[model samples]
Target chain A: MSWFGNSEPEPPSGPSPMDLAKQEVDMYSDLFTKMSGLCFKKCVVKMHGESDLNVGEMSCVDRCVSKYMEAQEKVGVILKRAEESLAAQQGGVGGPAAGGVPGVPGR
Target chain B: MTPVQQQDFLQHLESQQRKDSLAMYNNLVFRCFDECSKSFRSKRLDDGETKCINVCAEKFIKLTSRVALRFQDIQQQKAKDEAAGVQR
Candidate 1:
């Protein structure tokens, strides 16, 4: 799917583009599993009188997923800001102090 | 980026992704079982239990896709920035 912003249509050297695509799918699948699991824990109550999720629970989960992802982005921004400041303090742009942060979903 | 560094990052992502998928699997099974399995009178799932589990799975899948789309949008933005040579 032209992942990683690699717009060049380069021929395969080692790993095929299919391999990279699989990795990309794996990344998103894991993200979905982890994020939804967490949001379920947060939004769903242990006690349920009916088999179906109530309207409130459903809406809460909907909001929870969006907010959870947004929180990640917001935290990413703060993390970037902190890293940038640390880099400036170290007298360089994105010096060693600015790295080591893990990639978010899809990098 | 160098091949070694690229490999390291990909390994990191793979390991973390595996861990997250496993954790979610265990959590999903445990919680759904706990919530849906109420009676021990039979070895089979009752109607209510089956229905509850179905609903639970359906809801979980729904939530996952919803978050996935949101996540895709964010990642697409990041991809565009990276494509523009804005290194993160």
Candidate 2:
């Protein structure tokens, strides 16, 4: 999904938008896989006890998803703030080559 | 650079990002497992171990966020010093 959604100011200059979408899907799956494993580790701990998810495990998974998303949100905030601060420090010149802004060269 | 080179560069970046994320995921697993896992006498996890792992994951994420903020502050200060040195 587009992080900016519909509010994107302009098309980003890179691999086509379709590639970006694909990247997003890859990222989502990565997140889902991690969350699934975490919840399994947390809730479905007792594999030998019951073959099916117990009432508590079911609800634990439910809260696990929500709480995982919240954790993602918190982390995203920190990352965004860090990116913004870095960009500002480098005088708004940020990208793959986010070195300090270079002095203008005479042609 | 040529279009082919640009595409290659972008592809490299995407690949690097995937590597980075995977490294991070591995880190979480390592940390939570180290902090939570005690005994492997049985294949099943007990209630206490499960709770420990759950809390460990949450705290690990929170810890990273705290570090990110601290890192950003240090970077900002370093940047300011660099600018000052340039002026001097």
Candidate 3:
């Protein structure tokens, strides 16, 4: 007896677009978390000796967080410029060209 | 396109986009980690190392973009020269 009638339908080939976007967001969040952890270790020089945290250490942590975010933004800008140039060279209307305009709102 | 075919195409596009984003993230992590981990003997980041890592990330991005743009300029110039030569 053949088992063909008992076979289940194949699962979707891949994740949906919304699922993909969520995954991308999660991946970026994870990356930022890792960077923050590293930055915290760097910025927090002295342990408070007790459970209480010191203002100096807290300030440093804040600076580190801002710096990390700035770095990410810088990298993003570089990538965006590269993509824009690449798109311009390729003569494609999409890619970076669609999103890359100077002094544009919501960019 | 049929509904099933459209869904399949969308799925494929989503997967590719995810893969590309992952690759970008990996590249970033690698670059940042390498810069940040230079003084990794103590398993903690030093003040100097932190500063270095921050500067490194910024400079790396700048350098990458500059090189890419320079290469593109050269290619464009070469193409222009070739066209001029052909005209001559």
Candidate 4:
């Protein structure tokens, strides 16, 4: 259905835009797998019956996803600040250093 | 597209994907630690922990949008200065 329609015409014979979209999906799939493995280790202490996921586990998973999104936003903010300061310095604008250096996430 | 063109396009996408994946990985680690790994005694998140996770997420998003607005201001200022210089 015309999802990623661009002004440029479709190439007659090369890797289509669909391939690019597939790559994006693959990247996100990898991210989901890693995030799930990490949260599972951190939150699922007990099996607690044979229902696959207990109530506590389910709640923790929900929180975990929300927290991860938050962390991404925080990191993005910090990164942009850092970039700006670096640019300012290069431009001789003498901008102040980034405030409250945000810690690197995930490692 | 020619073989060279296709290779270049794929290379660009790969680099962008790599950067995104790394950022996601880092954010997940930090957020999980902040939200769920406070106490090692239990794997289950307590109500407090659950609340903390939600709040932490919200706060970070707020901070990000604020910073983005500030960055936009700088970009506009830069553009204005460049335009004035060109007119001179």
Candidate 5:
């Protein structure tokens, strides 16, 4: 009845390294989709006769993409902290602290 | 590591990746909404909205860092109590 030594063969714990890479690619694809949808909604309220984006619309999409990347970078920092905390909780050890990066308010 | 152990680790990592992706998606949607997409009348972001997006991202980062710092303090306290108890 022991968990680790159960007679039954355990299932694969998770995807292989290759599979992990594939998942990363998939995630990027999803990001692209989300970005396109958001940018379109923000920058293309009306469909003009021309397929090309106007100057204003072009600038908007550019700004949208830039902002998205900025948000993602911020999210990355928070995500690392989240993972560290989760690991610490599970393993009972000291967790990571913020590096106190300057320009990051709420210091 | 044994094959079983390796598999277990991989599974844990997979789940972690899933959680991370979900979090990113949610943050992007909410933060972007707050920054841009204010008026549907125009199909473009104004200068103010663009600036808002930058500030919004920075604010969210700060907020999470604050929470993480709090968690770290609590963990240190727990570790300290455990150490003190051992001395008794």
Candidate 6:
């Protein structure tokens, strides 16, 4: 959609899907870095030495990161399913009601 | 307004739209945090705690869908009831 009455920008010339996926991963990693930092600090109360975390502490951080990723994936799946079911209920096979066609069951 | 003034106004509007999109993203993150970090009892998350967060997210979306459907059902039923009443 055009914003502020500006014309739509041209599509990127380079690898679009890869670029988009990389961008998404970067955003998620930024979020994960913040969350994992907090969790790591809490779990790794005492560092063995400079730049050293014990096995338990390291494991905790690993698990925390994994869990965060899993949570993100789960949220994505949940939203996708909700959209699909709502679409079905609205008379589309697996998404929101399509445009056009009267008395097609979608309001 | 002059052409330059119009251009500036459009740029400002675009910036505001970007801010709004960022705010929407932040709100989603906050929602996820609420579902994931409900309790801070221990420094380390228990075995099932992470799983709970995933489950919570899934259930929350499902609940949202159900609520929406229920609302639509109620509206349909109400309309049907009103039509019957009118027919009577």
The number of clashing residue pairs in each candidate reads: 0, 0, 0, 2, 3, 1
Q: Name the runs in model 4 displaced over 4 angstroms.
A: A1-27, A92-107, B1-88
Report the Cα lDDT for residue A88, model 2: 76
Per-model fnat list: 0.23, 0.00, 0.00, 0.00, 0.00, 0.00
**TM of each candidate vs. truth:** 0.52, 0.47, 0.38, 0.36, 0.40, 0.32
Clashing pairs in 2: none
Indicate the worst ten consecutive residues by lDDT in candidate 5 chain A. Answer: A1-10
What stretches of model 2 exceed 4 Å from their correct place?
A1-9, A95-107, B1-88
Q: Write the per-residue lDDT of candidate 6 for residues B1-88, one digit (tens) a residue.
A: 4686566555655665566446545644565455456467888766565665455444334333333343345436545655575589
What is chain B's TM-score across the candidates, in the order shown? 0.68, 0.77, 0.55, 0.63, 0.63, 0.47
Chain A TM-score of model 5 versus the true structure? 0.66
> Candidate 3 on A1-107: residue-level lDDT in tens?
00111112334654444444344434544554455446545654432133233466455555655565556657777777788688888887555532232111123
In terms of docking quality, how is candidate 2 classified? Answer: incorrect
Candidate 3 Cα misplacement greater than 4 A, ranges: A1-17, A93-106, B1-88
Predicted complex 5: CAPRI docking category: incorrect
Ranking by TM-score: 1, 2, 5, 3, 4, 6
What DockQ results do all the predictions give, each relative to the true complex? 0.21, 0.04, 0.03, 0.04, 0.03, 0.02
Put down candidate 4 lDDT per residue, B1-88, tens digits, no spaces. 5797667657766776687557655774576455454676777877666655555444434333333343345435545655575589
Error of 6 at A33 (Å): 2.2
Query: Is 1 or 5 the stronger prediction by lDDT?
Result: 1
Interface RMSD of each: 5.8, 13.3, 18.7, 14.2, 15.9, 18.3
Highest-DockQ candidate = 1
lDDT (tens digit, per residue) of candidate 2 on A1-107: 22213212325654554444445545654665566656656765542333345577666766776677667756766666666687778887654222111111111
- Candidate 1 chain A weakest lDDT stretch, 10 residues: A97-106
- The local distance difference test score of model 1 is 0.64
Clashing pairs in 3: none
Report the C-alpha lDDT of model 3 over B23-80, residue by residue, as the tens digit: 6456656766664665547978887666665665554343333333433454355456
**TM-score of chain A for each candidate?**
0.56, 0.76, 0.58, 0.56, 0.66, 0.47
Put down candidate 4 lDDT per residue, A1-107, tens digits, no spaces.
11122213444665465465444445434544455555655655532223244466566666665566466557767776776778777894644332222222211
